[model samples]
Target: MNKQDRLNIDTKCINNNSLNSSQEIQEFLEGYEGYQHLFLIGFESDIGAQNCESRTGQELGPNNFRALIEQLQFPSSNSFYDVDLSSLKLAIKDCGNIKPVISDIEATHQKLESFIKQIRELSKDSIIVVIGGTDDLNYPALCGQSAYSEKLNLIRIDPSLDFEDKYRKQFDDLEPQFLEHHQSHFKMTLGNEIILEKLGEVLFYGIQGFKIDQDHLDQIQTKLGGKFQYIYFDRDIRKTMFDIQNQEQNQCKASNILMENRILKESQQIELIVNIDLTSIKAQNAPGVSEPCPAFGFNTQEIEDIAFNIGKQENLRIFTISEYNPAIEKFQTGNVLCSIYQHLLLGIGERLKNQGQVIVANEYEDIGQQELEQDYFMQQAGEHLQLQNFDFDPSLQDFK
Candidate 1:
């Protein structure tokens, strides 16, 4: 693909400077060496479908999401004055979309992995946000971690566990492995012994019990043993607004507590990759996903809260939003998608301020050599430790 063909967010969204010259988010687009917190990339590929029956049109997800970001209004100081939204915006560099070789998915995965490695080499601290065509895109995101070799705390916010007992065979056959919620590439990537050997921890959150294959989860849990954490699904989260009034307790708060504790502390830079499938949400809120379910999933606010919480982490190396299909609900899904992305920025900005690292426009573009060296050191140290293949202690499962 030619460089010109690669799509990115239009500059119009960031160019709004009605307040002042320095106030606009666009003023902060410092080339590579700056205070940028995110590198927005897209993976526009949907070749992983098992058949035409499962779903299509997810390939349009990235561009649709970009359009939503462009159309939405930016937040004001009244909403998030503590965080430097302008600086955060300046730090972002949309690298454009990666068009996978649809005929050969293996080649597509390799191309994506290579691209992610190049980005990691450019900046370790910057979060990589990969807008995906489908859930299979998560595999490439996970594989991208190999570039840093950092111990990862993979957090999957989905309605059901995507674990397959015979994942190895499915992968070998190159079948449409991730067509359904039950059979997903995540199963092969996260449940694989080879993959787990390199991971520090894996946690599954917001799972729906009825949708999952209990036997498959059991087998994966046994394999992962202490390396995994499962936050079981409770029916209360699926209650409608009216039903919530009758409920005795707030289910969201309970889940939030777990999310709050899991935020990677600055002291231990455990690499975080959040894979959020739009299907994880209630059908009413995300009807455009590849496979929407009316029966089980979190409400809009709950998923947004979860996304915001994940975005707030200092060690969030990668964040992927997948399976959004504009073909389903068109504008309705588009608006929901925009809200999710906007809230994520707010959360990240708040955390940056709390960490006492509020980025100024000028400070973003002119990063010093000392700062570069520190980032490099951290990346190297993480790679070295990953090579050691250290076993995660069972005590790390405190969230359980």
Candidate 2:
């Protein structure tokens, strides 16, 4: 296998040729409007159980999982998004007009490229929400043709940065592999074409990290013009707060870490691709991740608070939650799955036109939209607006 390459993910657990309707999942995939949203999960790792290892995290198995997909469909409207995908040969049969396209192939690189191609072919405007086997999938997931990718943005919510250096030994030395790797064995993906490219296609990538990657930081800096983002959950924030407080001289480090994400958000108009990993939450609260890092994920209240902020961002192109596995050992994992689903589901609901009324604004002109320092927030959410918020409070003393 290539360095960054592995076998396509194994998804043999998916037995149905179609989705089974249920209540919970239906709510999760709630706001599809004929536009497609693909949820690719990295269930093969620490989160992906060999035989249901530790079922303490989130689980959206085929049953409720189908409901999640269905919820993404139009509210009996927005007909353009309703694509009949039975022909795609996915493990699930009835994924609504949307089918459950799993990348269970042994060739991970092949699967990744194939899935991206399939998504591009299925619909030009579809949204791919990959649940993810690992964080590495983000770049290859964008391997579809570049013009199509120009419309794509990445949004990742995890506590750690998937630094290129972190997993150097995982496969071959893959940093250089993408430039030299190509395969043509996928017969069942979207467009049925074999193509390859590295990183030119994506618009913007949004990553929320707790323990970030230096390479990722570098990319965020150089690629994003020094605006890669990371969101520390309350606990991680508190932890950083404590660490900084305990430090003798470098006291500003703690304050900088705490304010890093918002500061990045404040500086630039981030056209986004939203990728969320539940590991950003407390592992005790969410345990089914492939890798349960100590400093990731949000508290119960933090989920929606962050999602609300994300939903409020205008430049968001795609929103994905990675690391959900249901066929594991415990049941709490399933509960967390339900909770996180509900969180993103609520975010989608907020954006959906069918779920009653959407409070669309030119920009947040309300006084409440102003920063803590009393600066106003500019137009943000979905790409039409250059999301700029004028936050003048450099010091907490300003707010005090």
Candidate 3:
């Protein structure tokens, strides 16, 4: 199929000058040279969710996300990260939704892969933000990025392990019953040997103990070895936040510190693909998902912080959010998801601000050699402790 037939643009959300007082993100240009561009692409399908016996409203996630994003006003010139927003020269384009080939999952993935490759060809440095369908979209997104990058790092923010043992076989070779039970991550990573070879430093954050099976965890550990690491939602994440709350009087600053120390690291220069599943968020904050986590998950602020941190990575290529079900939404999940996109833009703006700047010798010399050494040591110590603490078993708790 042609590009026009495979994609559906939503005209209602694009440059509608109805609201004159404030500027919405939708007003940004479809194309602009010499600017840091952000492309918004949507995948409209829930067939993968249906196959996995999950809820079915995720097909509408992209449209709902765009609707809420249209209602949010873009950051003013003086309001962005304490820096002049105009200097960033950011451009946002809504590329519209990919017309899903409902008859076959492989066909839909091929279309998505082709679309992403085209975007990469157009602007090699542009950031791509993919919304909805299911986490299954991650497979195609990775396939597209692989065309440009050989070494890829993936960070999955999800509660469940999403490992289907049957996905180890080729998509065409899988039996009907096995195909029906496949999840995104395992199918994309463990199932495909090509992807596993290129993958580097996979991190699973916000993991819930009860949602995953012990056998899958064992297999992941055995296969990936030291490269695979995870942080539990209940044990590590919440406990760290509770500790921060007790130590720091300011809640906002505390959250910032938590994200910076735990997730964001300046030393990470490798290319990254961040996949976020809405089910990783707390049900109270994001109840609309293929599968809701009523008892454990990241809060709204925490997830937003994570999005912002992920955006700041200099080599971040693709950012995807999946499994958002608007059918059961309580009118809050859409707004929360919008905020995550907005924060990601702000973080991108911060990255742009740091690019192409000339640093003088005097400015560099201001930092004492002693202070530099201390900072390096502190970072090394923190990394060591983080890895050491990751050796715990997730099956210890029965949160499910």
Give the candidate number with the greatest TM-score.
3
- Ten-residue stretch with the least lDDT total in model 1: 16-25
lDDT of 3: 0.68
TM-score of 1: 0.73
Q: In terms of lDDT, which candidate is strongest?
A: 3
Candidate 1: where is the Cα deviation over 4 Å? 1-34, 50-52, 74-84, 87-90, 165-182, 190-194, 235-255, 260-268, 359-400
Ranking by TM-score: 3, 1, 2
* Pairs of residues at least 3 apart in sequence or in different chains that clash in candidate 3: none
Per-residue alpha-carbon lDDT of candidate 3 for residues 84-165, written as tens digits (9 for 90 to 100)? 4434456566766776776577777777788788777656667888998788888888888878777778888888777864
Better of 2 and 3 by lDDT: 3
Report the error of model 3 at residue 329, Å: 1.2
Ten-residue segment with the worst summed lDDT in candidate 2? 180-189
Tens digit of per-residue lDDT, candidate 2, span 177-279: 2121111111111122332221212212223443545565565455445233444445456666567778854443322442245433452343355556656
Error of 1 at 282 (Å): 0.4
TM-score (C-alpha, index-matched) for candidate 2:
0.48
